[model samples]
Target: MSSLSPTSPPPAQSHALLSYPSPSILLVTLNRPLAMNALPFQAHWDLSELWSWFDDSPTLLVAILTGAGSAFCAGQDLKEVQANRLQPPSQPYLKGRPPSGFGGMSQRKGRKPIIAAVNGVAFGGGFEMCLNCDIVIASPRAQFALPEARRGLYASAGGLPRLVHGAGIQIASEIALTGRSISAEEGIRWLFVNRISKSQETLLEEAITLGREIARLSPDAVIATRGGLRDAHEMAGLEETWARTKERYEKKLYGAPNMLEGLAAFMGKREPKWVVSNL
Candidate 1:
């Protein structure tokens, strides 16, 4: 697969940093460390495009999202919002908003898995992004919250629904209503976090390691598993659900090229050269 060289291009002003840290893993770091990586309007647009690029890029198999410096993200930029409101652009629709939802990944159906490496505070939209990720790795000092209610704002970026589904109705309600912060430990207890790193520096490391593990497997199998898990939640009837799951496996996994590669790799004691295919 092709890779991005260090000299390819400098970081875009709208982005903190976007780089390929590994062969198949892309690291998207929220760069505004000084302002806690707040998502200004431009940042949102950048994220929207970035997510689409990752989804279409054949070389990139997985991505790890994190924040620069100490904090993960402080949510939206209130100042930017206020300024935009004051300006009141003549063409409101042209103001550039992410169609994929806030931070690009929330409230949308995407195939590839994203891992949120939460290093510090993940508030408001930040927390919502964490909820949208396929996996979440948090630092011991990380804090998660949806403080929108306190500010007389609501979490409209799939935060409410994702939180409810990921953390349960009760816990989600408590977090949404109170607008208080929860520590990483509490997040683990609520099953929101997949793993806890000892420190902020290790958060991305852990996430990349996990992403690499996923990348090593058949991309088709990973996509199938992800799709099945997503579909499993909305399904009810046990027999029908099992049958559907089996059907997907038969169509997507069984007799697929990747399936043959996986079996051959195991038997031959060599890494399989897998191909990307929905079939």
Candidate 2:
């Protein structure tokens, strides 16, 4: 894909390193490697702001999230939580993370897609975030676990239900209750992980390739198609979700400029130029 025009970009942040690896792809690397990329309370808000910008940014279509070192994310920072226990109840730290859940992902239904390039350990809250992401590409060394139960904390960040949806009740229960570590191979077996790369060296490259495939298509179509898929996964019934998806995207997508361009390009046997999606 060709480079795109820049829009108002995200501001600098303390816990994250954000860069545009490609014109349509936003790469966010968790910078707290010493802490195993553990998200303290405030990092949640910081990332929430970033993700909001990515969703709204006309130049960006996909986001790739990975950790700086060998851990994608260790989940929430327990030490910070423990320290906050000593603070006064009136303090803001006591209020907990925003309604978006851990790292603004565990419970997010964002507009754009986020692909998790699982480079290493994804434990607790880290694993939770992956459960909600649109795609997950794991490294050979990648391991996922819901060890929060063993730590006297349930995987309360929406991972439990989503796990059951992907891995079934018995499997989800066994993993959650035992807190056993699941390797990348086993993750694919349980149908949680999309696939593992050949090695850690090529993990990010593989993820970016897949992101580009999505980015190359009509932006409006991709958004609406993704929304429909998510609705089927998260909403009530098949018919109801289909009806809702039609009402939400059918007219707008079929009538958009890109819609005409796509059809004309197809008939003319040429490449279609997509406009920034307003959907």
Candidate 3:
């Protein structure tokens, strides 16, 4: 699932390799392995557009973000950072990551779900991307860290806040402030990783299986459910989050054909035939 030979079909856009492993699945492989998949600023904007396309695409319900080689991502290319320091970009948009943050994963509140399949090293912006994903399935060899502090930088791409939101302030402080690398098994303990794969060889397959499970559900239900879950983490006040979730998806979901189809499928004792989400 990771290899992208020159013989492979052209990438959907830039800075990554895209493949439709399944009708509902998008497998996005970060191909900059020589640099341990470290992404430059422009790469972030390219990825933002790619995710926007995925969110707007009716056919893609789930996305899997991985890397071509031994690193998920080492975060922003430090070489790029140093270059920017030496010779800053003349234009505003060229200076840093887009609003979607690093690789369009961190700070992303997209309509569909993204599953982080951490194959190897995930540091800095890489870890930030994992923090925001709905689910993270990691390889046994996978490693995560927020090493920005070691570089005299903090996780400005939204990792720190989301880390605290996910695993409490203590865990967040320990991970971010210490600049230590955590293993995939430890990630499970910290509640950052959903599961660890049997081995690195099987990581993508395991992720695909999980994504398919979600893809088989009512698309509208999935979107609404994801909205509710994200709201719990991103919004304040229980009652306010609850009310906002209802207001956001209720009317559309209640009237959607997928809603009716799901119930009918249950009553009839058959698998639901889902359509793309219009929610």
Which candidate has the highest lDDT of all? 2
Model 1 / residue 206 / CA error / Å:
1.3
lDDT, candidate 1, 127-172, per-residue tens: 9888888899999989999999899899888889878877789999
- Badly placed stretches (over 4 Å) of model 1 are 1-13, 94-96, 234-249
- Model 2, 1-279: lDDT tens digits are 233844786955769998777779998999899999999887887787788888888878999999998899998888877777776445584448778888888888888899999999999989999999999999999999999878888998999999999999999999999999999999999999999999899999999999998888888988898899999999879999999999999999997988998999999999998888879
Off by over 4 Å in 3: 1-12
Q: How many residue pairs clash in each candidate?
A: 0, 0, 0
Candidate 1 vs candidate 3, TM-score winner: 3
- Write down the lDDT that model 1 would get: 0.80
Question: What tens-digit string does per-residue lDDT give for candidate 3 at 1-279?
Answer: 112122223225557899877767889999999999999887898889888888877767889999999999999888977888899888767677888889977989899999999999999999999999989999999999999899898999999888998889998999999999999988999999999999889999999999989888887998899999989988889999999999999999997898898889999999888777788
Candidates 2 and 3 compared: the better one by lDDT is 2
Give the lowest summed-lDDT range of ten residues in model 1.
1-10
Q: Would you list the C-alpha lDDT of every candidate in the order shown?
A: 0.80, 0.89, 0.88
